[model samples]
Target: MSESIGPVLRVIGCAEADLPAGPARQVAELEAAVWPGSSPGHDPALTPRTMLLVDGAGTVAAALSLLYKPVPLAGRTYRAAGLSSVVARPELRGRGLGGRLVAAARAELAADPAVDLALFSCDRPLAAFYEAAGFEVLPGTVLVGGTPEEPLATDHPGFDKVVLAAFFTDGPGRDRAAFTGVRVPLHPGDTDRLW
Candidate 1:
């Protein structure tokens, strides 16, 4: 890989039938490093499409997944593209590779006419990182993940979370003040913690 500024970036769709095994395996390795164990769906990258930052030699430097699902909000269902499983190689931490990849995901979502907004949650310490990448911290927003049988909301006791969001289209995001100081339901389902 180059020691220069940027690394190769690619956005892969879940239905990418031709994704080569090499990159796929590299993605799996990167995911495993961050998620050492298994869960319902394990990782969002394992579901919909993915965005990857591959080194010059084709090794995954940082990665995240873009999964879209309809969530009932404000008495309407909105098409949201949620970012999940974002990770950067441990050795490359301070290089801003993760930020670059995050920014790329935002750009992709912002440009998509079909996408309503870009939403996700991160720990309080990481809130600044996502904000630098253009995601606004939703003051009191809570994303609900988990199965319908046992739902999990970010605002639940003993859990500290910060919702990072970017409103792209006209409907839901038109009123910016609404998102602040209010709790909103994302409802990504039980398969993912907070896709």
Candidate 2:
């Protein structure tokens, strides 16, 4: 799906596997630039879908990936999609492009009936940035990643993380209390741990 945000700017969405070579390379480069030392591609096992904000010149101005799966939380399962690898071109920071892209992604998830909620962890300082895009901090909540035997948590030492979520389904919204003040096991496996 693609939407025209302006005459010279547009936002497009596609499964990561279906992304063309040029745009995929651009997304990978943006990811590596923003997050040094990390692999420059999406984890196919995570069922990632790419969202890109492209300029008139076909340059990827901002990008983020959405990963979908069933997440167990508070003794129940919820269809969840997480926001990952959110980044913008280095020269484009502070221009609100990232935030706009985030908000657009949130809206896209909200429209998907299959998604019960959107949940992910962000660095403490970026909480406010995500909050402005319609995500609420799930206080005292920690997401446990990796396998159950080898887990990584947001609350681990040296990590300043905050769990943020947007409940899309009525049931999940009403059951919000079950999410807060608890540790939710995501177990997305070793690759892309803590996404």
Candidate 3:
């Protein structure tokens, strides 16, 4: 790994209301590129709140939107954090920018009093990438999202997602067994196709 770049990590905004007009366009552009065939302002889970990793020259090296929803499972609800549109400038892929951004997001989750855990889905080939970035792949585990009337699973055909997760709010999360070998109900809603 190159000497970890001392990029500036800042909270750009959390909701549409939080985004300053100046950076919102850049965020949306990055989102469209990272998550193709999707438009901005579609999912309620993807509140406009975003985080940025600015390189030393002040360019938006990487960006991602934060998603939050109360994940209910096994008679309990955990405040969960989800990540979307995580991307680094195409020219800057192997320099550790993406990993740095993810690490920072994890720190944000851990520091929040309400966020009990963080989870996201990635393609099978990207599982090792996330693992290198500190996310653990939950084998045989599935995240049930979408509407309660028509739930969607990460394992659904055509998606073949691998669930990556980390826990923070202590208590039950301290026990890995609680999350292993089970299907977790995430229910992020229909608009959040990647959740």
Candidate 4:
């Protein structure tokens, strides 16, 4: 665990069975704070192959989940990593905890030979933050389940409504090939609705 200004960010590779209930609850709380209306299910724990936890003065500040999955993009087979459930405590925002957690996850993902690409979905406001972290924006529709929808928005049509936007990622150059101006596939979980 590495201590930051107020919290200690620890990257843990623990199975679902190993994480205690207290930490799990904290993770859920942070998730809810970040994404309203999203259910933080209790039964199936979020035990990503790689997880990062940020604790501020003994309290959970931020966390991220990473999973290695096969992603088919542009008719090519890519062993990519899915980054999900990224959240930071309301009081901890702008402290760089989110960026730190993401950087840690990226490093870990890059270490795995099978993980050639990393993917995640973020609202428009945070797009700049991700770009600063090395992710480049792509112009395309994100197919969620059976429907292809628009990019994430807060109001109007709401998150369920599709919008014209694209995915972004840190260009693959440091170790993996850079993905510039590439149309990659993004699976937003729901399978019945086509975006």
Q: lDDT winner among the candidates?
A: 2
Task: Score residue 140 of candidate 3 by CA lDDT.
Answer: 81
Off by over 4 Å in 2: none
Error of 3 at 117 (Å): 0.6
Which segments of model 4 are wrong by more than 4 Å? 1-9, 41-47, 56-58, 141-185, 191-195
RMSD (Å) of each candidate, 1 decimal: 3.7, 1.2, 3.7, 5.9
lDDT score at residue 84, model 1, on the 0-100 scale? 81
Give every collision pair in model 1: 146-189, 146-190, 147-190
Instruction: Report every candidate's CA lDDT.
Output: 0.72, 0.89, 0.71, 0.52
Q: Give one digit per residue, the lDDT tens place, for model 2 in 57-139.
A: 78999999999889876677899899989999999899888998999999999999999989999999999999999999999
The C-alpha TM-scores of every prediction are: 0.84, 0.96, 0.84, 0.67
Model 2 alpha-carbon miss at residue 133, Å: 0.5
- Candidate 3 residue 187 Cα shift, in angstroms, is 1.5
State residue 54's C-alpha deviation in candidate 4, in Å: 3.3
Candidate 2: Cα lDDT at 127:
97
Clashing pairs in 3: 13-49, 14-49, 15-49
Model 4, residue 98: C-alpha shift (Å): 0.7
TM-score of 1: 0.84
